[model samples]
Target chain A: MCNHGIHIMEEVKVIEIKKSIFEDNDRDADNLRADLKKRGVYLLNLMSAPGSGKTTTLIHTINRLKDKIRISVMEADIDSDVDAIKIKEATGVESIQLHTGGMCHLDAEMTRQGLDNVSIDNTDLVILENVGNLVCPAEFDTGAVRNAMILSVPEGHDKPLKYPLMFSVCDVVVINKIDVMPYFDFDLDKCKEYIHMRNPKATVIPVCAKTGEGIDQFAEWLLNEVRNWQNK
Target chain B: MHELGIVFYIIRDVKKVAEENALKRVVSVVMDIGEVSTIVPEYLTDCWRWAADKEEILKGCQLEINTIPAVTHCDDCGKEYPTVAHGKICPHCGSTRTWLLHGREVEIREIIVPNN
Candidate 1:
């Protein structure tokens, strides 16, 4: 009875902190999203491999949509602001340049910083041109409502199979360079099949930005996505 | 190519854990690296040496990397095999479809710290 009077404390407090590798970037992206929502702006992360005509697509889209929408862009590259400069010259839209330094992808923190450096006042569309890499960019979510991927026709149809994760993460798949389809052996049905297999709900829109073919559908779809986001 | 970037993440996470535990230095880090993560183990180790060497609190910190193979399981015949060799197809059942059960992980599983 005397020995039973002493009690042993075996309950230790265990703190749970679930953090991701890109936690800092995710937080920054969230802040950017909140800021955009308050400003009534739509943010889109455009991703693709090198030479996928992402810059060219932007040039065309900005030219087409500038009349109706207040468009701004944040361009990400490894070393130069060449794309940003090109966009500025092409569309006369206020553009901000982001150099990823040595990183292959642009995180949300970097996007947020780039957005802060620019003036997006009364901007309806804000496109963040992600660095031209397929893999690493997929892992880094920049708090974009729509993650769009640019897949040029000549890059091979098996690209979606080689990198399924990127295709899976994308909200929209833009098949660029439809103008070059005559020279290449790119079958439209095969590409759509691959995308559907990876992500059934993903939007696949083929566009020849050079000739402005399917640009209207792309614009209308983007507007719908923004409107849907607003409604939500 | 950017394994150094991952090292920064490891350092940041280790610092947070060390601060909470009142540990003065981090001695070692254990990671469960998936085979299909596209991360080179040699590059990761090299990056760890370069970055971890620069830190005074973790100069001699050892990196323990456990390679997790990408294993896929076929639904038709119920076969499990390495993803590298299988190529998403089953050997016994000969199916072009299989689900990746493991491997795709890139996480710092544990950290060893010096006594306070």
Candidate 2:
């Protein structure tokens, strides 16, 4: 046999790298959380479906808490500056837009990149308005101290049942558009029950972002959370 | 789609492994994809092909997926059943106190490198 320049390998080496694809992202998220904790900053990841009043709720909450809590916002969308602009214009908060290129979700690394632009030292709370989707956002941790989702009245009470993972991952479930509850078949109690079933420790708050009703409760919850996070 | 994002993660992980082992090229990557993992295997492989070819180390790398069957355990009946057939609710006891035992996994099992 004439041996050419091509060398015949002895054996193929198989490396046993049994690891989850999300492992790296999860570790990054934990590090980010710890860093934020050390800096006394609370990062809140807010997720919802499109047109679920996430922006409106944020504007309302930011307006109420801006005086007390030093707040900043990061809006993550596939491609849009509308949210960032709206949030900045509405609340006059330091807001930045993060385009995920074409990604459906924002991982911990992307969250950290977005946070780099914000003045983390002066900010007590940084709110990440995650891309409006239930499934993908829940799959990736954005290194936030808390996770919240707004379930509007028009979206029905069966959302928790349909998207169990989203419900399970959420620390708080904000039921927005409660003013239209009379017009819709959405049952608030049933919705709370379903949310509790998925996550017993989840705090459910009903709010009308349009009317500014129940915004105080949400604000109070957030203020206490930020205080507790900083203290701990 | 999420498949593209997942492909990027796989490429990053593979490149890191290659760097650690001082390997030049990878031949195949094996993955254990659970049935209820919500990742379509076809889409994943298609995305992997499009992304892997762009990487010098994974130019023609093949992705092999092992589908793990979805299983659910019933707390009430103390029994296990196929999750796809009966979801959330236990079939034997007709109870909603059922949780997934396994089937939501997206793991990279191994990588085969060509011996230099």
Candidate 3:
């Protein structure tokens, strides 16, 4: 096939894949969505900054629903499984910690692997505690029906302005660490106003996670959302 | 960063394609990165230089990034604007109501190869 001494009217054919490499991850996530739907499991993607009391909120919420429902969590961290260990110790439930190694975000493939270890059958809620980052994690879709973002008081109210994409993508916003509201420069009303401007549909809930304040309302909202999905 | 994992995928896929097609090297890769995707171009470039050097096909390939701007359509005024700005509401109408027209993607558009 190498007889091209000169120009001999060569033919060229380009086969376009027309498929995204991320499609593999999307396919996996779609499978997860189907599995959750079949099992009547409500999946929640919990996102926030590094110290936004995600773990604390998870602890308090799981404690409230521990006896009522079968809850499991997939915790993502950069290095250690410390968060997963903490979640296990706090909730006394089955949780798999996914180590993203040095990656700042967790994509659908990572979540799918974590889901393999945790059984969603006979489970009511499957919570994915995303990596402790605001920007990158928001770009990924983990096939979660509900997207929850935590904003602690110490992180300031200006977070909505700085990282608008994160807040905009979330279905629910939790103002965690409400007990330290007075000590910080955060204005509760101002923060609420910013969030509303960013996303009209997102429900903002303030809670003192460490002190179990307003958690019942938050849990009720979450259960209602899950119930609607289950009923569908 | 998310770019590192993206780089690995790019290299793996491109290398496999080139090998199957009997190609020596890749000259350029045209990638479509959505403006709202939160992937920093600088970080991606840095990661590409480090990761691409390891792949035989993409050892010297130049990654040309074509940014696709996320357009927002205002439901009230029915106008289109580049929604690359964070929390892209309507620039004309002060409505939290809007629709995402494009962006929110990360895909390879085309590839340029060396005929040699």
Candidate 4:
């Protein structure tokens, strides 16, 4: 060891360790998934950037499936509880507000805490409207069985090129605000092509949350996914 | 977007490991960051410096980052290529059946402790 050295040096101990910084979070997410499966709870993570009509869509979705299946929502935000308030007023179902305390995303442990605060004894579906950001939320797995994302018409169709990971990780891509399609010059075919290019297995649904256009298909897909998850 | 939040997670993990191993202090912590990953190394280290100093075990511990190149594996050609340059397409075979092989890592490679 001294051949390449300048002179004699003090002896030192070298310990080799290779561990993932995300190991703990991954393990926690796995445990939470197992626990949710055991309890017959289908958790869906609905993600999108700010002003993507996530709340409005969720309210409509809840109105459609509330009678058939017991549903709850975990509204996560950086500091405000306005979405949770709106959800409670609209759905009247159990809605828990999770403040990330200036954090951009919610991790598995944080989701678990949100779950503990709400009652899931007889709930069939739990939707987690993760913090309204496309970048950070895609990096963390919150133990959700299904991942859904929304992109509004105003955000343009080039979103897939800029944020590829979000599209790749998502199971379904909701192109919200389709009613404004005539005004925005947003080509639905081109956008769908971009999403398919990144994620071939993704289901692209174009909907208008405000006018309730194409929401039936979204509801049907969600119910089918929940049913499949429950059966599995 | 939240490098400080990630730094807190790292500190919590390092603290747990230190406690389990009965380590009083640490010299450095080495990380393997992927090129395609959304994390910014400079932002992470900056956040780490602000957070680690508050904790006793990691007060002056140095943070080292090792960047891992992003690579993609093409199913059609059975070859691997750089993901940043070529993206989801296979450069060798021009196929769209390519998947990422590496460069999404957020790992801790080593934790160096001072001589006893």
| lDDT values for all models | 0.81, 0.92, 0.81, 0.88
B1-116, model 2: which lDDT tens digit per residue?
87898899999999999999998988889999999887899999999989999999898788889999999999998999999898888889998878888998999999988766
What are the runs in model 3 whose C-alpha is more than 4 Å off? A1-23, B12-24, B69-72, B81-105
Query: What is candidate 4's fraction of native contacts?
Result: 0.58
Cα lDDT tens digits, model 1, B1-116, are: 46877778778887778777876666567788888877799999899988887887777677778898999888888889888887766888888567788887777777655333
Which candidate do you rate higher for DockQ, 1 or 4? 4
The sequence of per-residue lDDT tens digits that candidate 3 reaches over residues B1-116 is: 68897887777777777888888766667788888777788888889989888877677666778888888888899888887663556778777677778877678777766444
The residue pairs in collision within model 4 are none
| Local accuracy of candidate 3 as per-residue lDDT tens digits, A94-185 | 88888888888777777877877888676889899998988878867788887999999999999997888798889999999889888999
Candidate 3 local lDDT, residue B3: 84
lDDT of 1 at A128: 91
TM-score for chain B in model 3: 0.86
Which of candidates 1 and 4 reaches a greater TM-score? 4
DockQ of each: 0.15, 0.61, 0.33, 0.49
Greater DockQ among 3 and 4 belongs to: 4
Q: Worst lDDT window (10 residues) for model 1 chain A?
A: A3-12
- CA RMSD for every model? 7.5, 3.6, 4.8, 3.6
Superposition error at B4 for model 4 (Å): 1.8
Ranking the candidates on DockQ from highest down gives 2, 4, 3, 1
